[model samples]
Target: MRVTWRDHSPHSEAFDDIYFNPLHGKEESLYVFWQGNLLNEKLAGNVQTVFTIAETGFGTGLNFLCTAQSFIGQSKEAQCLHFISVEKYPLALTDLAKSHTCWPEFKSLSDQLIQQYPPSTPGVYTLAFLEGRIKLTLIIGDAASGFSQLSAMVDAWYLDGFAPSKNPEMWSDALFQQMARLSHKGTTFATFTAAGAVRRGLQAVGFEVEKRKGFGQKRERLVGRYLQDNIPEPTVTPWFDLPSQARPEQVVISGAGLAGCTTAWALAQRGIKVTVLDAADKPAQGGSGNPQGALYTKLSVKPTLQSELHLCASHFSLNLLRQLDPEQTFWSECEVVQIATDDAERTRQQALINEAAYPQEIVEDGSKDTLSKLTQQTVTHDGLIMKLAGWVSPADFCRALLNHPCIDYVPDSQLTELTYQDGMWIVQTAAQKTYHTSTVILCQAEATSQFVQTQHLPLKPIRGQVSIIPASVTNQKLNQVICGDGYISPPFRDHYCFGATFELKSTSLEITDSGHDTNLHNLAKVLPDLAADFEKSKHLLTGRVSFRCSTPDYLPIVGPAPDPETTLERFAPLRKDRKWKFSNVSASHLPGLYVNCGHGSKGLVTTPLCGEYLAALICAEPLPMRKPIHDALNPSRFLIKNLIRKQI
Candidate 1:
């Protein structure tokens, strides 16, 4: 986005309009958006549990800052402000900082926002503030398409964008329809524009718009409420439909690995009591127990649901790691380099760099020289350099996450049975110890499907082993994590961890000599010069072997678990007619059963976001993901897909 400074105020070059009324911008923001939405009354005391605010434009994020400051002032315990905004042409960091200079009152909050501001990438970024009490989902794309992908129940709207005449796309019928889709009765909206077409469009979509005294010298502005929500929700894909549930008194997580610990952290921060159960003696004893894991994203050449999820997860995970590990002892943003060893891989990397249009702050194409410089070792192939990504001690991260005051970590307890009765879930471990809770989440990797409710999920187990090689004085001190078919981290506790063979056939938990040989081979391939000493002394390598949980589509299975017999019977009509729309049929789910496993190898980067998503869904807050991506990760997707294909 290009912005020009005029009289010390930021002016949008694309829309040819000023960002705000420059005279009293702060007061105008409070007057037109804050007080106009009646937030003073709605957010005072304990009127509601959560109040969501969505905006058409996020110019300088001034409105968000003002709202965040106010929300924290009035919001009490268990009350949250979920702020979402869409921006087609997002300003750069320097530009945003320059625009934010006009408000000295919002310096503290504005600085925090600036510090956490994401790279200029086109995707959804869910950021947390005030200990997750104030959430922000910034959609960096076109307003209408972005909101169309979002599934939220908004309580207020900040219609702040360029004028209707200059930016017609922001004031279209589609946007109005989306507003109606996300709103219900009593939902409020405040806009700086009072154009006749704008008022008519909103009224046509069930909003009651009225003119109010404008800010400053302006004559009038539009303030309204969503009185009648006539907009119809999707009749298709009802199996992926998500309805909110009440806040539970207690939640039980099946595993104490990355997924469970992160999930517990998310819920505990939201004031929910969580109990994490694990089979091992301590947390992160499974695949997440790797000595060091790469924190990076494998972006596709073009954007797909999988790629978008990765982009979103990478951004979220990067921020979370920093927040959880501030000292850089167990986590460090030392950057990561994924080398393309062969000609075909080089071509693919080149195409990704040329076609993907990703922000340089997130990823950049590495020529052979760039790769060598980043790794501080000699390399001959092209690669991708993840700037903000790094290496993390997964075990340490998980252990620290489960140390929350609201979390109870019970080791040596393997969840064996789950049954929901009388609005409560009875959870039993291997020793017949039973605990009752209102909700149960399965995060136990491959063991997640051991329960009857989740047995239908097509979870696959892939064996992975990471070899630990002692770093010698003669070996080069690798600064960044390097990846090819296998990955090697920088030194951790005087040992370099590498390899990790992804075997689909082997389910062996015991480490084998072949695993070490495979690690040596991959190490030789990815970094021949660095592996010279290790290859000669390969016998000194020892590793840890564990099975990783994956799905047929490779996406994590999240969201509520479908009732086995009921879903089979209800969706059986699809077998006769693939396009069958059971308009009268509603999907059935196991009351409070949810799944959060199947992270596979990207567990370090993906688990945190999925945890936040599930927590938001369970807590009845605005979701942390787009609707399509959420559906793609739905636990019932395989069932519905197979029912239509007549394979079930």
Candidate 2:
């Protein structure tokens, strides 16, 4: 059947479901037997961790909203409640708001969900709600096709598809069989259908099927349990042994930019002493000292692994920034306009907007006139406006993060070398002073490559220079951040920061007249009215230059590093034979050595989240993101992939 969004407004006469029939006052259908009996009590009472519930059809999201409300009332002290559902034909954002008005009792829960609902993508879209207590995973696609690729275990089943005669695909034997494969032996399933094929298919997969009273004018429904019938249990992967606990006293970090300050804060929070060493006279004096940086997010039309990971990190970082002191740190809720320079780029943006199912409030179509008004300029092209995007001061945020009580600020101290001896990582300064700690984190930007241990790592230094200009009263009228070929921030600190020149071949940190002229020329293209102010800004264009350390793929290298040769030799057999097994194998990591570097251009958006992720890994806490991100940022990934390809 061709699918469309179901109208769920209480005021609208089209909203009709027997289970929630106000006229009949709540009757039981097979839908109740399947959803209420199987899912609610069975898996909830048994699971030790946060219970996650996923559904294929989220028509009005009644099933998920109801499940959340019930779980909150019944399961107290449950670590978290996760309700994930999908809808191929999602309603407009306004329609969702109207539908939610029907349930005033669930207003608080619905409001939070509505606020962070991601733009619809073709694949999985994960959302965190209730201050990270509840998670919602939505996969908008065909039920059978979507479930087959989903990698989550369900404790209970809610089989509430349309009637088998009307929507046979929803209740097909193949679908039931797939569900059987996805469910555990003790999984209880309930459905409003008592069809012979449904029962037979479930029973064929070892479930004990039974009939029950149906809800809402329906005569009968079915509920069943998967019983073990002497089949062998699946083999579980052996858990890796935990690393030996280290003496948690102190750590020495060799940088004072965003990465170094963030790591220092993470260590300080865990009751560990932190000494941040840097050659600059003050913190954020390097690449992170940009006057204003944009929180840019690159999203894809299809839910690729990279897009998924970025969505999670973006939201996490946004929320983390909200909890900081906004006065001392510069952050704005202003929108960001990602103008399409050409038709091809516009097409890509349109495709992403449709797949993303982003709220209309967050992303909207813009005309050239609207763009001109938003940027306070005369002319502009049509494009997509991202309301959730904004700008922040990288230097100020770094300062705020490093303001913790347990951190010691040791600026003007240049780190010369790091030596691991006698169970301690000794860091020596240029003045012959030595500081010994059990853990050492390297975050000194491009200077990090100077260390002997990380000399072999592929890190390149690129110089970036941003021009500072005093914004006139007219220039200050610009309300939002604009991005075309280059980016310009809204007026801040009595001046607007614009025209950042990127040079990959430049080695000298000295500010040049040519670079300054290049910046002014670039700024003129975006804001032509500011031509008169350009010369005055040029006269005041005394700016700082810093080198950004970046990797080839643009993803940062985090986590532990092992000896390269040893890692290659150990994984060699697995490369030759995919099924090869090795025993008593251990990672040849440099003990207690970790690096959080190579953030590149997206440092403002990716760095803070990276710091949190590194902290979670070091402390052995539950990660903020799923498994793929953890793997993407793994320090050993390059070595392992190269070894597998025999290129190492």
Candidate 3:
């Protein structure tokens, strides 16, 4: 977003108005939003543990910064401040830091925010501060569209945007309707505008709004609470509805790889006890054991479910990595240069950049010369340089996530049977040991299908091999991670990890010589000089092989496990007439059973975000993604599709 500065004050160029009161921006934000919504008094009490706030325009983040600081010092009990804000034109990182210079008291908190700020792009960027006590979800999109996609119940609202006359479209009935849909009976709202159109628009959407004395030069403002949920919400297929589960006290998680460890970390952060059962001797012995895995995604030319997931998950994972390793020792932000290896791929890359399918900060056009210059070596393709990606140590990440005191790791305990009685699941291991919990989450990739409830899940195993070799003998060092059909990670721990061959037909876990041969051949095609160096030292060749569980569609499954017998019987009429609406009946889910698997090769990018989504659902908190995207990742989607086609 372009901003014009007038004597150290921020002004929006698109709306042709000032961002806040120039002389009293801090005081004005506190008076209008903090006090208007009664945040201090509400936060000081122990009635609620999580106080969620939603805002319209996050022009300079003035309201958010004020509330974050206040919540930290004023709250008597430990509480989390969940702030969600929407913006179409997000400020650039440099400009955001520049704008915050006006407030010196928030230097420490503002610095943390700057460190976690995401690129100016359209995605859900959630940042954490004060050790998870505060979470800021920044949705970079239109005000109404962003709110419509969210599935949340807001406690307070900061309805601060450009003046109603300046940005008339944002202050319409459509926006207010969404506000009412996301608000409960006691949800409160405060706005800096007192326009009659806004008051009437809010009243038309079930909000009891009234005018109050305005801040500084302004004469009047509006404040109110949602009296009821009278606004009509869009209809959703009942089968895709998210089933409610109680806040789990003790949880059992199978497998300790990325899926398991990440979920364990998410739960442990909320003061929940988790037991991670692993078949192997320790964590990261499965698909997550690779020495190095690149944090990247191959964006599709056309927008598809996979592309949407990749775009959003990539952003979420990057932020997660930074939070995990702030010093950048186990990971590197050197960026991934995804080369378009052929003319067809080059054309697709051009289309992706030219059509502006993504924002400029996420990706840009690249040339062969640019690739060579970035890597400091010979390269052979023009590709899209992805700014939001790099490489990470999957093994280290899993270990760090499982290091929490709240997580109990069980080794060599392969799951044997699961029995449900008294509303609790009993998990029995091969060692004849049993554990009980109210909730059981299956993160054991393909092994989840061993159970009757989740056996219908269409999870397939794809074998992959990554060959690791010592540093290249070439004088030039690999400056960044590079990708073609496979990826090559930069030097770390005295070795250059690269060459992951995708084998669809192979199931054996042995690292065959032929697998290394296929990887070397592809490396030769992409970078001949590096291949020659590796060829000179063939005796040093070594690799690891693992199987990635994936579904027919590439999206990861993250939701309740549906009971196939009852769910199939309930929606059986869809096979006779595809237009049939089973709106009254939701899918029958196995009580307290959830599964998070089928990530395939994108586990590094998709696991953490999906884990967060599952944790939010279990805790009855706001979701972290769009509604359609959440449904697209549902495990029951394939069942519904198959029933409609009479294939199951």
Candidate 4:
């Protein structure tokens, strides 16, 4: 994670290039990359559409900064710019901040980039600037893996890898093939190297190559354009490739909870009008009605579908929550302490710290004494501290999301049935009133299973109850949220919220005295010191109960709603072979119908990103996360797995 700085230049001890031209890095970038790739012309050509630029290397981000400056200076025809770059080994934030100071002209932009630079986790990190007109997607991994996972149609390429002699792996034939896969017929690329291997590799991938005058001391550079007369189409696994309908002008979202409201805001940002319907009398009157909810990434030692999605969601959640609640009234990044109650948990926490390579600012190892000092409370065991994890008022956040001008939140409008006809979905309410739209997203939690079409989806309702404890003046020093078997929040407005008991196979919303006792028991197990104070005031405990829609594996079900009968018939061959091959099996969706539910206990951290994913699917934008994460959240995944095992 450290960048070795030599002579004020960031030298990659693992690769080549001083990251920039030491003599004049800014000028070299503007000339060789900006002018060489004709970014100004390409950006200006797309009057209203997004002009995408892909880079093989994004060392100190000099190329991106210069390109952003160029885009801002371009003619009025240009609207937006998307820069996607891959870096195998990322420079730490401190090093990035130091290297960026060399370019005083880019001071403002550099400061913003440094402020939002993500942790050293190897996944895609998205950042926006210039009022969302210019976007950057930083892929922190090897070139081929990053490019293969990228989900965008690129318009230009910044082949700024280290010299072909130093980092040939980045300029390999496989990399060129992936580039070709993401490019269109007119996609152009430029690089500082003119090696034969580079030229042949690009040409073999269908690009017409040429030699050009290089900038600075270099004599020549390689430039090329994708010119195959018959451009190949970008393809995914046929089963997962859902055909996208035209972006709807008006969308109807069921359930005005966290998922629905957030999705509404995301679509509204793209100028789409949204109508949010809820069965309750008000927004967040369901599972999201909680007084406070915690936010943190559910990570494991090794990357799995759930872990990857959790990591991706955690990053997206922080960036988005900050944007929406700039005043920090609805949520607070007050940090969280996850107490390790047993040796198993302590070892798991240690493995997470040592294996993930996460930035300390995001998550770090902590001792019992360190946590005690942080919370100003005595701790019996060590724990993992996530600096960014905290709590949010879900109801207030939902209200804020629905406050957008483009979103119309209708309360007490329960959707009883859905019928698709004439290329539009008709949503009928219990009152016999009907609403029609080209798109409908069901965010109605486990109640979504009541519909015959979605009955097969593996969704269950788990009842959860949280007991509220009045914080005494003596406990005012408890300044951080603490968690173990259950969680306890720091004093918030004369009281602390804690002790949530998860009850599976229960739909009852009645808060019981026994539930509060169970919570007290959990608190005693996690924090005995706090439990002693709570026990003396047990008579005053009050609580609330709600039901959360959960999946067996705990991952949320997002994306388009599949047609049950058709899907089973289409994938029937899976009964014989787990890896059944099918051609052109476009996703059999209940057209214009989608669902975002079953987020379970992680809705606060997961739903915001799930909202963005649903919005991207509807708007046909580049997905916020990679394809594998999408597959994990696919509503059809359970059915596919069962079919493969011949269980249905």
Which pairs, if any, clash in model 3? none
Structural similarity to truth (TM-score) of each candidate: 0.97, 0.71, 0.97, 0.95
lDDT of 4 by residue, 1-648 (tens): 455778898888776457888878878888777877787776656654567889999889999999888788884533677789988888887788888888889887887788678777777777777755678888888999888876777778999867889987788888998999888888889888889999999999899998988886789988879996444453445556655778789999999988888888888877789999898888898888878888876567676767666766777777777777878877777778889889999998889887866668678788989887887777889988877577888899899889898998888899999888898888998868799899999998988878877888888888899988777724546667788888887666677788688898666788899899889888877678788888888888888998888897788989898898888898898899866567666668889889999998888888988898788778766777887788778898888889877889
What are the RMSDs of all candidates, in order?
1.6, 6.6, 1.6, 2.2
lDDT for 621 (candidate 2):
38
Tell me the lDDT of model 3 at 288. 84
Worst 10 residues of 4 by lDDT: 229-238
Q: What digit string (tens of lDDT, one per residue) describes model 1 on residues 247-338?
A: 88789999998999999999999878999999999999888998999988888888788878887888798778777777888977877888
How big is the positional error of residue 120 in model 3, measured in Å on the Cα after superposition? 2.7
CA displacement after TM-score superposition, residue 301 of candidate 4 (Å): 2.1
The lowest-lDDT stretch of 10 consecutive residues in candidate 3 is 229-238
